[model samples]
Target: DTAVSQTPKYLVTQMGNDKSIKCEQNLGHDTMYWYKQDSKKFLKIMFSYNNKELIINETVPNRFSPKSPDKAHLNLHINSLELGDSAVYFCASSQAVQSTDTQYFGPGTRLTVL
Candidate 1:
């Protein structure tokens, strides 16, 4: 019984491959977000959706896309995966930022390239 889970907790592949990571939240929250934390420990917001509507979109690469089917799920799709794309992908959710709500994050999906 996990609050949120990302498929393929670890993904290893080469360059130019396409992969997707699925996320689901059972917390009944209204917002879902995708975040990337680099080796420098800089956590950047990639994308966010509220109730299946895109609310925040950061300056991310075109190869990365986020899809929210409902309030409880947001999936990330990566195209032409590059070596630079290797990072920890985290899925999170919150009621609203205005509410000063903290987001719940998954363990993280580690994508390694070789």
Candidate 2:
């Protein structure tokens, strides 16, 4: 079974559109994170949720939002998508948000804004 999974493996939309990526983890992890990989392939942490509480929110555009309905689910919703939003978004989870904790990543959702 896949420990972590994301819906809509590929997402293509036009600029100014709104889209959401759903993520779920079956590993029973308390902490979940959203990372964005830009065209340059540099991965940056956008948001982090622990036990359904917001934590470690990075300096991302206000257009990006992270919602955690439960401990095992963290979803990313992007508003007014722009060309710069085109990239691979990854959902990850770990036992805890500790530096030593091992994180399990989903296959990633590729978003292309035209």
Candidate 3:
């Protein structure tokens, strides 16, 4: 069984479109996160949720929104998607927000804007 899974692994849309991606985890983890990997392969955290509470990263744009319906699930919604928003999004979960905890990541959702 997969510990973490993301639906619609690939997304292709035109600029200015709105879209949402879904992620789910079954590891009983209390903390979940959303990360974006740019074309240069630099990965950065966009959002973090602990027990369904939101923690937005300072660098993320206001157009991007992350919602955690529960401890085991996190969804990302993007408005006015731009070409710069094209990247691989990864969902991850850990037992807790500890420095030493291992985070399990989902396969990734690649978003491409035309």
Candidate 4:
């Protein structure tokens, strides 16, 4: 069984479309994160939730929102999806939000916008 899983592994839409991606983890992790990988293969952290509290990266656009209803689930909502937002989104979980903890990543949801 997958420790971390994300829904709608692929998304294709036009610009300005709104979308939501859901993620769930069965590892009982206290922290979950969302990452974006651009076409150039540059990966960056967008948001993180620890026990339902949000910690967002300064570089992330305000249009992107992450919500955690509980410790086991974190969902992402993007408004006015732009071309630059077309990338692979990864959901990850760690035992804790410590710098030394290793994170387990999901397969990733690839988004393509026309």
Give me the candidate number with maximum TM-score: 2
Over 10-103, each residue of candidate 4 has an lDDT whose tens digit, in order, gives 9999999999999999999999999998777887899988899886564888899888999999999999999988899999999998989999
Which sections of candidate 1 miss by over 4 Å? 97-99
Per-prediction TM-score to the true structure, in the order listed: 0.94, 0.97, 0.95, 0.95
lDDT of 2 by residue, 53-96 (tens): 99888999999989999999999999999998899999999999
What lDDT does model 2 reach?
Answer: 0.95
Clashing pairs in model 4?
A: none
**Global lDDT for candidate 4?**
0.91
TM-score of 1: 0.94
Candidate of highest lDDT: 2
True lDDT of residue 33, candidate 1: 90
lDDT against the true structure, per candidate, is 0.90, 0.95, 0.91, 0.91
**Per-residue accuracy of model 3 over 13-90 as CA lDDT, tens digit each:** 999999999999999999899999977888799888889987556588899988888899999999999998888999
Per-residue lDDT tens digits for candidate 1, residues 3-103, read 98888899999899989999999988898899999999999999999889998899999899888877888999999999899999999988775448888
What's the TM for model 4?
A: 0.95
lDDT of 3 at 7: 83
lDDT score, candidate 1, position 76: 95
